[model samples]
Target: MGRGARETVLGTLGKATILQIPPELQDLTRRFGEAVWKRDTEDPQRKLVLLKYLDGNYTNYMQERTRFHKSSFSLEILNTSRQERQLYEFIVSKGPEEKVWQIQLEVYEPVSDPSIQILGWALVNDSCTITLNCTAERGDNVSYSWGSWDTSTSGLCSHNGSLLYLSYPLQNTSIACACTASNPISSRVVTFNSSECSYEQRGKFPRTEHLVLLVVVPIVAVIIITGVFTAAHLAMPIAKQEHLPLAEDSAVHTIYSQVQRVESPDKEPTTVYASVMMPTA
Candidate 1:
């Protein structure tokens, strides 16, 4: 038969075999070719070409199209939505022999900034604890890490999962902190001011100072009041007495009476004398 006639027959046979393919299989095949072709446009020199087999025997056709076969097939998917599992079938002798293969294309977006929250903290102690949670709208095998960034240094602490617990000293006001979310495909980082997670170092005087004031002030006040009462008690006189005597002498008589002053334990006592006279009848 002539070459043209042989090609016509082969084409007819190939079409009939394709018509017999299941709808699902046909869809799979079409999607595979489309994905490969889209990849080819970006790099025409690395086009993917499938082998054309002869009669249902691999031995007969294996060597015939060695030069026509592509080195390998690769698809570059820019968009994650476009990634999918693809099927391709290689037919020999118009359908008597066939081989099927699949290509799995996975495209994932980079992780976005993680959500951060302060669980609790102690400012006076200069310690803070925070939680970093990372998530992606479309990604798999995501991971998280925590770190501190300052003018002096940047250090990272690794954690295996999406959530990370970070506890660090908030010693410097200039330091900043961040969480990094990553996947096998890509990574992203989000930063925050350290002050956001830290407590205001309890001002100059903390709760301890207030507590000291509460305990010390009353004691001091009691001491001052006691001192004042003791001083007043010591300054006042204990007692006072006055006496007058009458004598029956014809002439005037003078008698001296001694007045004694009581002394405090802390002071010396004082004394005074008064003269008394009696007129006789």
Candidate 2:
């Protein structure tokens, strides 16, 4: 057959010419015949030779001029797609004894590169919740895994599936987080730095609130204290001046009352009695 025709047939069979036959098709080799044969190269136009076992010798059935007669033949096909059945037919007894063989093949592709995304704003200080997402572009029978490497301590943490929750007090240095996409055929991984992630404030109070506490509160207190001290200082001189005259007036009134009492004693002589004591040498 032409190269195009062979490729068309192989494509219809859903098989690649370069790869090995899948394990599900291994039974077909025994069912067809003991000897299994397949193409070793990627050339689509390569001849497909079938060997027939008869009369204690193997004969090439594709050769029209061969002297050996054909009874049973075996052929092996490789690199078939999964969950598909293909049919093969050949003439055995020339007229009505033609038989057909059916085989099922299963093939899987390698896992594609895993994609990693931060679910929300990630922070190192444990102020906010952080999550990670992992996905694969294409694969068959695939699974996901997550891991992180502590750059400071060379420690490793592993988890399964597409989602991972991160906790606080992360490593001091940058952390390498990875997502791996795996399948029976192959696996792929992707990595990113935790330090590159963005962080957001989740608390009701923000850094600005802290700044207000640190700066504005002390300033307001100082202003209030200064105003109180200024008001007290401004009132002290007024209070002293208003009370000084009252004290002097009370002293003068006491002396005047004593002199008047001695002068007017209801006509009785209010005399001042004095006793003189002599000092003897």
Candidate 3:
């Protein structure tokens, strides 16, 4: 099956018909889905059941299409690759979150050498959200295989045909979505890395580099402020060491002197004087 918006139904295509489907196509979700999708297609599943499931998927697809294009468009699946990986190729065109079905479904003839381009992204804020559109340059029907190159961070990334989301939103990470576009005739591969789009990324938390600035910048500011304060404090003395008012600031702040008098009786004034300064404090 092709990658639907949420559920990547390994779409077991039965056959295509142009007849008017009953409004009861909704009923097929339970009864019709249980019959065909329950197991891999046997005798290629029931034709009527698959058609009902297709209608449900197409209904969901149309809702998305109506948002961007009010006009009608065409989609055709080359029924050949359904067994290549027992998989299906979503025929998509340009735009963001382009419908996995892109347009209504039809069985197309096999074409060759499909060139692919990963186009615009549609982003939103949640855990993580980004949509990558993969379009075939030449062939419209080809399988798309998406994967993560980094085995260590593989679990963090989730992808469908064109949609990519990360389990963790704010962190340092390099995520890649590669689509191996192949058909019965030839195959080609194209890839895009989220890291490459820092210049173009959108959303609440597009990159983790912002987180680094949030944490590191304030610490550096505090260190600089403290250093400046300490320098300014040292630049001006709290008080001169020679002018300390507290005696406890130093062990010695007292001095003793002795004076000798030689002439005692005659003048009562003959005395020798010597000047001494208390050790600079």
Global lDDT scores for all candidate models = 0.45, 0.50, 0.41
Name the runs in model 3 displaced over 4 angstroms.
1-128, 156-162, 165-170, 196-281
Candidate 3 accuracy as TM-score: 0.27
Task: Please provide, for model 1 over 67-107, each residue's C-alpha lDDT reduced to its tens digit, 9 standing for 90 to 100.
Answer: 22222222222222421222322321213332233332333
lDDT of model number 2: 0.50
Better of 1 and 3 by TM-score: 1
TM-score of each: 0.35, 0.39, 0.27
Clashes of 1: 0
How are the candidates ranked when ordered by lDDT, highest leading? 2, 1, 3
Candidate 2: Cα lDDT at 241 = 88
Tell me the tens digit of each residue's lDDT in model 2 across 39-120: 2223545633345543345666534322322222334333355422222222222233322232222356667788877665
Each model's backbone clash number: 0, 0, 3
Q: How many Å off is the CA of 3 in candidate 2?
A: 38
RMSD of 3: 20.9
User: What tens digits encode model 3's per-residue C-alpha lDDT throughout 181-239?
Assistant: 65554556666666643433554443456668888999999999999999888866755
